[model samples]
Target: MKTNTYDLIIVGGGILGTFHAYHALKKGLSVLQLEKDNFPVGSTVRNFGQVVPSGMAGEWFDYGVRGLEIYQSIQQEMDISIRNNGSIYIASDTDEIQVIHELSAHYQTKGYDHALWSKAQILAKYPAMHADYVQEAIVFDQELSVEPETMIRQLHIFMQAKFEKYTLKYDTTVIACEDGNEQASLTTSNLEVFEGAKIIICNGYEFKILYRSLFDDSGLEISKLQMMRTKPLPQIQLPGNILTGLTIRRYESFEEYCPSFGTIPVPEHYHELRKYGIHILFKQATDGSIIVGDSHEYAAGNRLDDLGFAVDTYINDLMIAEANRIIPMRNDWITSSWSGFYAQHKDHMLEVDVSPRIHVRTGIGGKGMTASAGYAEQSIEKLF
Candidate 1:
């Protein structure tokens, strides 16, 4: 019997929506999760897979900490491409060193595990990183690295077998949603209808089409980030997620926690790099290839087309130039490169209640992969 009914109907199967489903199922709610494609091919899969709560600040940091817990707990059950490799932020100079010291102080009161490693300690662990680039580093070993491309898919499989109430409908697009006081219903592209007590939307940058005007009126901006992957190099030994100097200056944690974050003036040479929002993060994949990159270009939610589908070679050039300064690498090693788009509010995540029953949550920005699991857990609690 095609009852076409569930306790909860979730639109979009990205990190945020999927986590929402995970928590809802924990409450024993019958869930129908709809995905526009065969599986998630958005920000959830397109990232450095750095689950570093150490890089987050304020409430989001709390969420990220909880996110780390959820990810590890899931790892205990299944092989989800998760590695407890830890995360490290290497200071390039004395100025960057000062901020990391203050960051350590901020976390000390919070009871998070962290350690400051000296130059020799850094060299002993990651020999591939240039010795000269190391001033000092703060290590968060509890942080994790996940293979983004496979994490969500494995998670879906894990959930299906564990929770019989969970139903995932991939390649199913919700084209229309009708609001109701008794029961809400949505129609898919195939003209099939689904009914549930509540509906939550977690589509990343594809923000509109469903409720176009609501998101456009909302203060949301989309950022297009460019990233690259290197060919497998068996000799290299770059462990964990390596966030360099630019990252130290850019992450929300440093800006909010470190007192000296604003005091140090970035040199003039960084102007061009900063203009494009360039930050270098490297993580070695299971294939032994190092993933490097990231440069940002932004536009308002309604103007997503302005940030086209094309990858800018110049931005990749700028990233590779910065990568050379951090590690010993040749241009030939960079085998593939691409771009990923994420949406964010300038101040925080864009959360709007379309109604008491319908919720729109997205614009999680760069923190989606790190914080969504925890954030969604809290959100589900509040909603229920």
Candidate 2:
């Protein structure tokens, strides 16, 4: 390759793209990463920052396990601020408890370590929890959490400072991609051309811009969510990544559990919450602030404006109320709230070969944070 030519050209600057860059650099491959905006403002930063392999299954679960290892290695090598907070999923109903029982058995077969706690044990361990609804819990001691608000930015800074093979281009949009017999050339918004042996597009949910036909035909849909964060509560200490019964419905790991464990009989009044794909999960940020969310709605397109960025106050309030029901808070004072968007497909992730040398990966849904890095590494190895 020429001096100016890169070994790999990675499109997008989100976790998927950056993790690809990280792995490529690990293999001593020169990389050029492009981002349309000055920084990442998508689902990469607007999430609970919970990296829980316990929430995934099969290969995805393995990906999450590898991702946690990567997070740990990066944090130890530098200061990426990864916290080993672990995760606790509470079962509020009999159906949810059944899922826990089945999942626990499944975990044992898979060599995943976790503790199944009775309500009494849970109360003894965390007396602050509201015991009225929670009957049992599963504690995943290996789960990890990071500060989503700052993790990506700090990782980029670390890469720039620590690696000489990496280059990041902000405010740069890829306008065209042409693959040759042995290499690919990409034209940016500035009309500048760059060449690489392989071109990997990790644009996240912004699919239409680069490859509209492939994106449209890939069966990808948009998922919009509402999330909120509270001001730093110096007096409060959240146990870990707190998950409620609704999570069993949203997360894929509990799918088998659902069929065997049976469906949860949600209250008649709370039917609207279920209709909107709402779930309650909480995590404490490094600043001592609490992060709570979220509800899901599918969109026809991948753009945020078409789906709208407005946070539904009704849904937001319902989520906050549910969180309060689980753990009594000192105050319900929230400092920030917003809507987040990501890509999803009914079956598998939206990954396809746009050309012989050009590849696109997105639509991993909410599992982006948990498994993007590990999956990206695997994908790149297969590609090269």
Candidate 3:
């Protein structure tokens, strides 16, 4: 390799790309990371920051387990705002309660620790929770949370300070890529070229840049999600990740593990929830404000703009109303809201090598935050 060459060059600065760079650097491989923006503002920053392996299944769950270890390991080395607050799933009705109970048993069989909490215990811990809304609860105390807005930035800083083999470049868009017998090369918007022994493109959902036709035919779809946060309530306390009944019904782990799942009847009134793919979730930020979200709406990869950039007040109102049913959050107190987007393949993640040395690993969808750390480590090993 030449002076400007590296052992690995990672495209995209979100969690997927950064984690790949982290592992490459850990292996003593010289790494170069490029981000189109000054900083990451995609799903990595927009998510609820809940890292619950209990919400994942199979290999993804295994990846999330390792992700938790990776996150805690990073936090211990430096302050990256990692919290072991755990996650609690509040069951709002008998069907939901049964689903959680069965799911708990499934975990018990797997030797994963879990506790079934009575409504009394739920109320005692979450004082603000609606008494009638929670029929039962299941708690996983091993899960973690992070301050999404700062974790990546701080991780970048940590890498700069700790790893002499790492280089991070922001506001640099990769415009072209080529794979040669000896090295893989990419050219940025400035037409400057950098070479690497292997190149991995993890640009999240933005797929049209380097290999448009490949991604267009790769069965990728973009999902748009809505999010909101209430005004700071320094006096109130809602610790850990608060996942509600809708979440229990929707999270993949439940669908796969819970025998009662899909057997529960949806009342006519809840049709809209199913129509919009709404799953109410709450996570209190470090600033004492609660983060509320999210509803999913999708469009084909070629029609990313069809998902639209405008925030839907009706969706927010629906979320706020549903959130109020579970917790005492006042809609008028919600100070800020935004939309997040990510690309996903319905059956599996978008991972295939366009060339032997030039690899593509975008479109992991909602699994990115929970499993990216471990998945990227595994991906790096396979690529090299």
lDDT of each: 0.91, 0.84, 0.90
Residue 220 displacement in candidate 3 (angstroms): 1.0
lDDT of 2 by residue, 1-384 (tens): 222489999999999989989999988999999998889999899899999989987799999999999999888878887988789999888778888888998899888999999999888866767889779999998899888989999999999987899999899988989998888999988888899988889887886578777776778889899998889876667857888878865677888534664455666656878888889988888778888888988876545467777888888888877787887653357888998888887888877887888888877888988999899899888887
Residue-level lDDT of model 1, residues 76-120, one tens digit each, is 999888899999999999999999999999999899999999999
RMSD of each: 1.2, 2.2, 1.4
TM-scores of the models, in the order given: 0.98, 0.95, 0.98
Better of 1 and 2 by lDDT: 1
Q: Which candidate do you rate higher for lDDT, 1 or 3?
A: 1
Candidate 1 lowest-lDDT run of ten: 1-10
Clashes of 2: 0
Off by over 4 Å in 3: 1-3
Candidate 2 local lDDT, residue 381: 88
Clashes of 1: 0
Candidate 1: which pairs clash?
none
After superposing all C-alphas onto the true structure, candidate 1 shows an RMSD in angstroms of: 1.2
